[model samples]
Target: MKKLLKNIKLVLFFAGLVLVVFLANCGLTPLTIEVPSVVNANEVATFILNCGTEPRIANTDPPYTSKLIVGFMVPKSWKAAQNTTVELISSEKGNSTLVLIPSAEKEAASGLAWPDAAKKRFGIGPNLLDDFEWLVYRSVPAYTFINNEDIKFKVKISSKVGSENSFSRLGFFILSAKENLRPEDTDYTKYAFSNNFSVTNGEGDLVDYVNPQLAKVEPVKSLDNDFISLNFDAGIIETTLSNTDEIFLEARGFTKSGQQIAITTKVDKTRLKPLGGKKYRIDIWPRGLLNVPQNETLDRFEYYFTNAAGNAKVGYGNTADPFRYTFKCP
Candidate 1:
C-alpha cells in the first residue's frame, strides 16, 4: 500500500508540473471579444477586446517596457486611419489614445516593419479577398507593466464606415513589443477575427468578400489607375451562362464627360481565365482596354458575359441590361 501511494504521488506531481509550465508559457490572453455582425455606413460601429498578460514566473521580477500594437484587417474603402479610433484603457495608467503608426517603421526585435512583421506572423486571418489592408496602431507613451502585478488592458475600437456596401471577416491582431513573436514563441501574438461583418447604406454593388457570388469586382474601391478584375461564378447561381464552357467579356467604358469608348471584348483578346467549379475571371486595365486617349479619364463601365459560339448572354442578375460599375477612388 505504501509503494502504491508513492507511485500515485509521483504521477500527480508530474501532472501538476506540466500544468504549471503551460500556464507559465501563456503570454497574451484575450479574455472577451465583442464585435458587431452588421453595421450601417452612416453609423459608428464599436467593438471591444479585454486582454491580459500572464504574470511571469521569474523574469517578471523586473518591470518590462513595451508598446502594445493592434492591427486591423479592414476594407481599404474604410480609410481606417481617418475613420477609425482606437482607445486603450488601463487601470494603472487611465485611458490613452492609440495612434496609428506608419507601416514602414521597423520593430527592434524583428527586422521588419510592424505591418510586415504582423503579416509574417499572421497572414490576412482567414479573409478570402485581397482588397483588405492592415492599419497598425500603437498605444501612446510606451507603458511599463509592473512585475508580479495583475493588470488588464481594455481596447476599444470605434470604426466609421466608408461609402461602399461590402462584407468581410474583419481581423484584429494584438501583441506587445517585448514579445515580437519570433517563430519559436507563439503565445503573445494573438489574432481575433470577427464574423461576416457588413457595411450598407453606401454605393455601387454589394462588394461581398465573405461568401461566393455570381458576379463581383475586385479591390472594392478603385480608380482608373488601378487594375481591376471582373469575376463570374456560374455555379453559385443558375444563369444563362451556367452551362457555357467558353465565356467572353463584352464591355463599354465611359469618360467623366460621357464620351463612350466601346471595348472590343468579345474576341480571344478578352477571354476569361477559367477556374474550376464553373468560375472564371478576367483582369482589365481601364484605359488600355477601352483604348482611351490620355486627355480623357474613364469613369464607369457596362459589361456582360456571352458564350463563345452561341447567343447565350448574361447581364446584371442574368437580365438583358448590362451590369454597371461606377468608378470611385474613395
Candidate 2:
C-alpha cells in the first residue's frame, strides 16, 4: 500500500507541472481580431479570426475546438438586401430607375481572381437594402475553406436627389466569433456571429479613434519667408502606441471642381524642437507658397501632421496642430 501511494503522488505532481506550463504559455501569446482593410461602403468586410496560441480541445467527448462565428452591425438608416438599386428623378419631370442583380462572375471580378466556383453551390443574390443574416457553423471546416480567403460583399448607393447631392453613408461593423466554446456554453449566451458594425461617411474603415481625441488645431509661424511660412500643432489626449501610424492632415475645397494640393508630409521629430512648456513646433513651410494648388478656387485648406516618438509598440496619442493658407485667384 505504501509503494502504491508513492507512485500515485509522483504521477499527480508531474501532471500538475505540465498543466501549469500549458496555461502559462497560452496566456503569453497575443490573440487578435482583425477586419479586412479593403472593405468599402455597401461592402462586406471579411474577418480574420485566430484562435489562441495553439488549438486546444474545447470539448472532450465529441472532440471540438475553438472556432469563430460572425455578426453584423449596420447603420440605423440602412438595411440588407438581395440586390441594391436606386430611382433617379429630376425636377424636369423625368424619372429613371436602376436595378442591381447579383452575378457570380461579376462579383468575382471586384478583387483578385476567385476560384472557378468549386463544386459548392453559389448562394442567391441578396436585396440591396434588405437586412438578412445566416450562419456557417462547424467552423473548423469553414475556417479551412476560408483560410487566407477573402469574403466579398457590396453596398449600393442611390439618389432620389440628383447624383450630385445623393450620397450613401457606409457602416462599420464588429464581428465576433465564438471560440473555446462548449456545447453547454452559457457565458456568452447572447453572442452570435459577426453583425454589429458602426456606420460612417468616409474613405477609411469605420474604426474611429475616439478617446485619444484631437484637442486643438492651430497654425503658428516659425520663420520669415518671401512666400508663405506656417506651423501647426495637434494636442492628443492619453493613448497607446501603434505601428504604421501616420499623422494624417487633409485639406479639401468646398467644390470638387477646385484644385487641392498637398506638400511633402514627412516631418522629423528630432528637428521639431520644443517651443513652450507643453508645446512643440513643426515646420509647415520651408518657403514659398507651399505645395499650393495651381487653381485659386480653393475655399478651404487643412493639414494633419503625425509622428512616432518614445515607445511606439503600444501607440501614443500626442497633441498636434494644422497650418493653412488662402490666397486670391491670380
Q: Name the candidate that leads on TM-score.
A: 1
lDDT of each: 0.78, 0.30
lDDT string, candidate 1, 249-301, tens digits: 88888898889988644676688889998989999888887888989988888
Poorest stretch of ten by lDDT in candidate 2: 112-121
Error of 2 at 114 (Å): 32
lDDT of 2 by residue, 50-157 (tens): 322232222346432232322222222233333223232223213343232222322132231111111011111221221222212222222221121222212112
Residue 159 CA displacement from its true place in model 1, Å: 2.8
Measured against the true structure, the TM-scores of the candidates, in listed sequence, are: 0.82, 0.25
Clashes of 2: 50
TM-score of 1: 0.82
| Ten contiguous residues minimizing lDDT sum, candidate 1 | 54-63
Report lDDT (Cα) of residue 81, candidate 2: 32
